[model samples]
Target: MKFNVLNLIFAIVLITNCDIAFSQKLAVIQIEDLYLTSPPIENKKTSISYLVEPSDNIVIQYYTCILNDEFSTCKSDDLLSSGETEDYSISVSIPKDLAGKYLSYCISAISKSGAYLPSENECRSELITNGDIDNKNALFSYLNQTKNFSLYNAPITDAKDDVSFVTSNSAALSLSSEGDASLIGYGSEVTNAPNLPKAKEVYSMLDGFAIKSESDDAIIWGQFDTTPSYINQVEEIFPAPYAMAAILKDGGINTAGDMVRGGSISSEAQKRIDKLLSKDGLPKAIYHTAQAFLAVFDMPSGKQKLVAWGQSIYGGTLPDEMKSALSIKDIVTSQDSFTVLDNDGNAYSWGHSPFEQHQNIQTVYATRYAFAGITTSGKVKAWGDSYYGGLLSSAAIDFTNTNPITRLCASDASFVAISDGNKGVAAWGNDYGAGYIPSNIQTELDATTITDDFHCASTEKAIALYDSSHLFVWGDKKYGGALPSNIPTFSIANVIGNNHAFLMKAMDDVYAWGGLNQGGCIPDGHQCLSSDDSSLNLRSAINDLSDISQIGSFNTFSEFEEEVVGGFYVRGSGAVVMWGNSVPDGVFNE
Candidate 1:
């Protein structure tokens, strides 16, 4: 029975008296799958997103009350807050007074005919509130304790103000409703630009690269750089060696680079792009090399396909049949070519096929001018410019016969293949670049007994590793080929090397030895080792060493030549350290 009801009490009454006569009749509505998106917090807004069946003319009624005990009774007048909604979601303000106490909430839906779910009278949900998470560190701790560490897994947006929040260890980043981004925390600053959108999702790398998607995509590092004016919507951003490429929502590509421009897209590829745009295709994934971009698209026909385009300076393009997503499993690129390994382990070359067909390929590695692969059977092969490690040496063949290659690492012009158990090692490439291992080092490689913790790092001049209490260096001596007599031997956690220097992070301290100007020497005050002695100190100019997570390398331009010269250390606490001969010239504090 239905009557024009002006209050919730009458609605409840109508629901209770099912047999009562009314002026008009309506069907009862049902609601299911009721659940809370997240726990309510004290002095904070709690959002409840809901979807109910027979959505039309449905109303959501909710109320919250502080509970005294498990058996406490809640009266209608005891409701601390109450609200009604016709939309799918609602946010309620949890009062500060409720902190440290349990709160019960009742959420139900009723149809226009006064029919409701949950019959009447009982609250099915109770939650304890944690006092306000007003700071980034506290918020992260709460998320960690609750095991909901991914803060941005779901979009968090304030509809009325259009503000979004992004958190890092040191600060909270907010995009205001006015499209201004402000960093709030220790040493906080604001970059005022009336251009940023209320981001739905923002992706960031510790090296100061960030991009916010969902609307009018823009790049934010230390400063704001909006996407190309022609791009209406951005799906993803791919940072390549010398350029940045963005896949557009319309299946088109936009790029900012020295040699390649989105406007210069090939006519043939453009036609395919237009077809996808017309059908509203979706961008799936993207891969890029210095010279080319490969995009995967989900088409309207329910087929996943690939498209490739670039300068093609070295003949890089996918085969017609290989354009089908199923035909390719992985892709590796050399400076001028692309090698696609099919699912069956057969390899195909598009840009420069300098080698014969290879099968059963487990993995492939590349140098600037050559390619090498290790077969599933542990056999190794190489091809391309013989001068640049393209031709497998007799030593490689002999070494593999006794012990199959377990892994491979490369320098600009050399390849180092470590045999199984790391008991043996071999190299080939330009002789000056450490392509030929000295006989004495080979003897050491044979005698050294390696544990499961074996690690190898390579650079243009040498490879370094821990052997007992002494760090061994082998290769060209000009850079790091010779071990420094003053360097102490310690258990190393990780080691990384660039063109001319190496940084070793020991269990508690970090050590460096190589070209001083190229990052081999730790700047004064930055060392974890005190100036008086080699003892480890928790604090230094480099921050806390015990919390360091990993070290990464980045490319920097000096004297008009691009070189991978800098090392950035990311700490477990989200603090980052950038060190090297040259750091990018810009405000990186953001």
Candidate 2:
């Protein structure tokens, strides 16, 4: 046997070299693409990414743990090799008062030849309060220092960084400047950026105040404390001798030096007659007459008297030949008669129908018992008591044809007209709907104009005016024609009566809407006279009127009681207002 067969081949080569040094002293470490590029430090700034693989004589270490609440690991961080397969980046700055929670990381590889590597922990991440951090601690610190690594439980890929840190102070990390810094392409450190103002200019610059009229977009200003008690109830219900003799006889000024050189009175009418004579003063038995070249002021206990024939009818109480033959230039009245139009328009009347409705009358309209007139070729007349239908009896007219009338209105039994080439509108007698002339308004008969309301129960809805000044109404909307939603379509020019519907406006500006009781509407300052109202509760009480230049209306009565029958009238330097109920105060202070 050759030495016992060589001792079994040297014991099989020392048992195969002790199984190759125990399989090279047990080694295994792998980590790959671990990532986290900002986003996960609840109280703010963070970034972490890595990749490594080391096995042969390995050594890779990165560890951090702060677990507690029974999750155990109190706090750690040290073994950080960061060498093999090294690809790492880390930044963590969390502060907003860093409240706790679990956070663990591990990737240990050591095998430089004295090998004993088996540590690739990583799956514990969760520092959550705001959540973020999972790329398995940067891909297990990159395949635990990768060698010929093969890992299965892989997870660690989260990268989305538009660079954010809005304060938990890492120097306040937020760079997305101007216009969001060109939408994150970054390039804006600040340029012209100072904003925050308009809340009415920051409350008018914190109340140092200065915003008067940036063009007065008026939210509201002043002037309306019930407007001087509605202008002292329109000067105590349209007085001033029936509104200055219905504006010098309907403002065409028939005489009395055209109501004292009529420039249409209104520079606030001498400050509204010196504020109503300094608040109810003047007026008492002021007489200066010479054959009725009158100037009597009375009224304050003296029953009633305000007779002044034109120019200063004695406010200075004169008698110098009755102030030089009644230097009166105009004065007319009717509730029983009194007239004067001297200044050469010469006309006068006494009392009691003195010539029937005051013959030769320029305008007038009484009614305690009847009277009416209109002439100067506009023809219309009426007398008293035809049993309260007054008088305009052409056998109660059914239109036997007759024109040439340019306005005339009566109510309380009917009468209306606005003739001249059938500009349409006609009516007559005893309330057959007042004067019943509407076959659909005779096919719009060129409807030049028309108006009347006799307190209107239905004068075919009374209220009309056309020739394109359009303003049509049909029968008593409780008094006049209602209409007023903010009135814009304009175009009326003239139409009076005011228990409600007044309307003037070719810039003469007047406009009253309807109802205050049969007076129909006026009530804001009151005005409008001369147009039908012997009684209809005296036209509801009148309302609203302002600086007019002129206006008129009437139906009958003329033997010149200074005239007014089918009524209407207006004029406005200062006064001359009327609205039915038969105006008379010597046709306004004469």
Q: What do the candidate models score in CA lDDT, each in turn?
A: 0.51, 0.31
TM value for model 2? 0.19
Write model 2 residue lDDT over 150-214, tens digit each, in one string: 11111111111112111110001122222121110011111111221111100000001111112
Candidate 1 displacement at residue 332 in angstroms: 0.9
lDDT of 1 by residue, 1-590 (tens): 34211244336645554443252354444443343344556787766555566787776777666665422444565556767778776666777766545565555666655453322322333344553221111111101100111110111112111224432222335444455555433211133223445555443221123345456675544222323222347765654333345676655776543335222356677676677667776666555444566566666664456666775654335567555544344556655666655545677665555434577674677665677777654567887778767897888778765555645666556677765344767788877767777888778877865433455566654667553354666666655676677666666566666556666666566667666555566645445232333442323535543355544333211111134344323233334444444431111232
Choose the strongest candidate by lDDT: 1
Instruction: For model 2, give the 10-residue run with minimal summed lDDT.
Output: 201-210
Off by over 4 Å in 1: 1-210, 213-216, 220-232, 248-254, 259-264, 273-283, 297-305, 314-316, 319-326, 352-356, 449-452, 465-472, 525-539, 543-546, 556-575, 584-590
lDDT of 2 at 444: 57
The per-prediction tally of clashing pairs is 0, 101
- Highest TM-score against the true fold, candidate: 1
